[model samples]
Target: DAMVIQNPRYQVTQFGKPVTLSCSQTLNHNVMYWYQQKSSQAPKLLFHYYDKDFNNEADTPDNFQSRRPNTSFCFLDIRSPGLGDAAMYLCATSRGGTGLTSSYEQYFGPGTRLTVT
Candidate 1:
């Protein structure tokens, strides 16, 4: 099955500690994205990588960062996690081009639930 995989489905970290969440995919999609979701709120797009180009949302906090070392793998690093940062971190991959006329479909991972205490 070609899909996204996230490690440590649940993570617990103390306030101000650094934590890293990972995502990998077998789909070989050209676009990979990271999103932060809290409860009923809509998932917020943190950043995405289209091949070697990195795009970050303007409103994304500096505390949230991502790295795509390769096509199959990506990492989200929280420099200093706060209690408010506890939420589900999702990694997604999309095929085709992202454009108004393109038919791009995004597939998401189960997500990593982070707990900051």
Candidate 2:
């Protein structure tokens, strides 16, 4: 059951408005990361939480925020999604347990395609 899932695969929001995206998993993994990917570009890390140790990517904008209320779920909130926020939001998960050699191999969800008009 190591799978990541995202809801509302597509979202349409007005410019300078707020939006929230959700993710959940049955993997029981302790590390969860959120990534933003623009058209044809590599997924860029927005932030990650390693068993409550939150790590934010330096380039992530203030408009982007995340929350991990529990081990199985996480959320991405955009305070004011601009036109530039139009892209794909990918949620990924990985194990944080010892002896897991491939803990870094992230498993991504189908992703939410956001369109900011």
Candidate 3:
């Protein structure tokens, strides 16, 4: 199945608390990403690992980090979840085919909605 799935669809976190979200895929893809999307706004690219190459969005906050030790699993770690971190965290993956035109399309997970006080 070519799906990126996240667990616990909804997560409640306290202010300044830490949380971890998990993602997994069966696509055998080489690229995976984490995005943060707030209410009624465009999703912000957080970070991603393209195989062994790590790429981070310049605007992503320092509190957000990600790890992908292997091909099938990835994790997003929020060291200190603040109110501003309350948003929908989306996981995505892309198969390495070619240039942007061939491999740029990303498949998204159901997403985990984080709530912070």
Candidate 4:
């Protein structure tokens, strides 16, 4: 099985503040994804990485991502977090796909819970 790791289990931030979340994988999969999940809602794909290429959801704004193969890491940057941004940030990795949407066995990290004041 692939291993995905996320740092800092919990986070607290003030409204309009910027925050960064990170994820790293040992599998070195070609695709990586970031998701935002609410208390009882399904996870929503924020963006994904295919190697150095990034695919961001069209509706997601004020979000950015970067890849560092040297560390097998992907970082999610929320430029200005709002109350709505208070959610669990999930990091997942997959072996191969035309796009992340078509991938399988997306090994997921435990996630980082973000709280907005």
Candidate 5:
């Protein structure tokens, strides 16, 4: 089945080291999104790509960056890993753009758990 996939389900990085999480999908969706979930807290929308356009949430930190090299793949880069940055990074895809008539449903990958030491 066509779905989103995240690499290296688990990752460990030293403090101040850079780490990258990846997501790829076979669905050929037009929109892709990245989210950060810490423990029981709600998932925070870091940013998303609608086709080639990049949109970042107002609250998303500068430490969080994303790259969509192409339609089927996206990358999340953390310039400097910190203990507080450890969390489950989620990658999701949706068929339609944000609109009243467009479907808002999103399919997500299992997620990559990042641990900072």
Candidate 6:
């Protein structure tokens, strides 16, 4: 079965400090997405990647960065996180699969809850 994994289910970081979150997938997908959610608000897409090409939301902060080492791994780097940056970080993988039925579907990993202290 396809799977996406996120390390360190919970993360704590000091204000104005840098932190990195990791995500990996065995689904061999060509696309990955990183989202941030706070409170009851909907998840916001911070970054998107299609074969190493990055597309970011216009409102995404400069402090947020992402890296994809290969087809199976992606990383989210938070530079100088502030109190408002505390939220749930979600990762997902999708596309480039054989079947058209689930082609537009995304497989998500358990989110990493980030706490800013």
Candidate 4 or 1, higher TM-score: 1
TM of each candidate vs. truth: 0.94, 0.93, 0.92, 0.86, 0.94, 0.92
What is the lDDT for 88 in model 6?
A: 96
Per-residue lDDT over 1-117 for candidate 3, one digit per residue giving the tens place of the 0 to 100 score: 567889879999899889999999998889999999999998889999999788998888889999998999999999999888889999999886676545777889999999998
* CA lDDT, candidate 2, residue 91: 95
- Candidate 6 RMSD to the real structure: 2.0
- Kindly list the per-residue Cα lDDT of model 4 for residues 5-77, writing each as its tens digit: 9987899988888788889889978888999899999999988888778897987775555555553898888
Candidates 2 and 4 compared by lDDT, better number: 2
Note the Cα lDDT for every prediction shown.
0.93, 0.91, 0.90, 0.84, 0.94, 0.91
Q: What lDDT tens digits, residue by residue, belong to model 5 across residues 1-117? A: 999999979999999999999999999999999999999999899999998899999998898899999999999999988899999999999988566758768999999999999
Q: What is candidate 1's lDDT per residue for 1-117, written digit by digit as tens? A: 888999989999999999999999999898999999999999999999998799999999999888999999999999999989999999999875756755478999999999999
Error of 1 at 30 (Å): 0.4
Q: What value does the lDDT take at residue 101 in candidate 4?
A: 50
Better of 5 and 6 by TM-score: 5
The candidate that achieves the highest lDDT relative to the unseen native structure: 5
Off by over 4 Å in 3: 99-102
In the range 1-117, model 2's lDDT, one tens digit per residue, is 568999889999999888999999998888999999998899999999998888999999999999999999999999998888899999999886667454677889999999999
* Ten-residue region with minimum lDDT total, candidate 6: 95-104
Lowest-scoring 10 consecutive residues by lDDT in candidate 3?
Answer: 96-105
| Cα lDDT tens digits for candidate 6, 1-117 | 779999879999999989999999998888999999899999889998998899899999999999998999999999999999999999998875466544868888999999999
Q: Which residue pairs show backbone clashes in model 5? A: none
TM-score of 5: 0.94
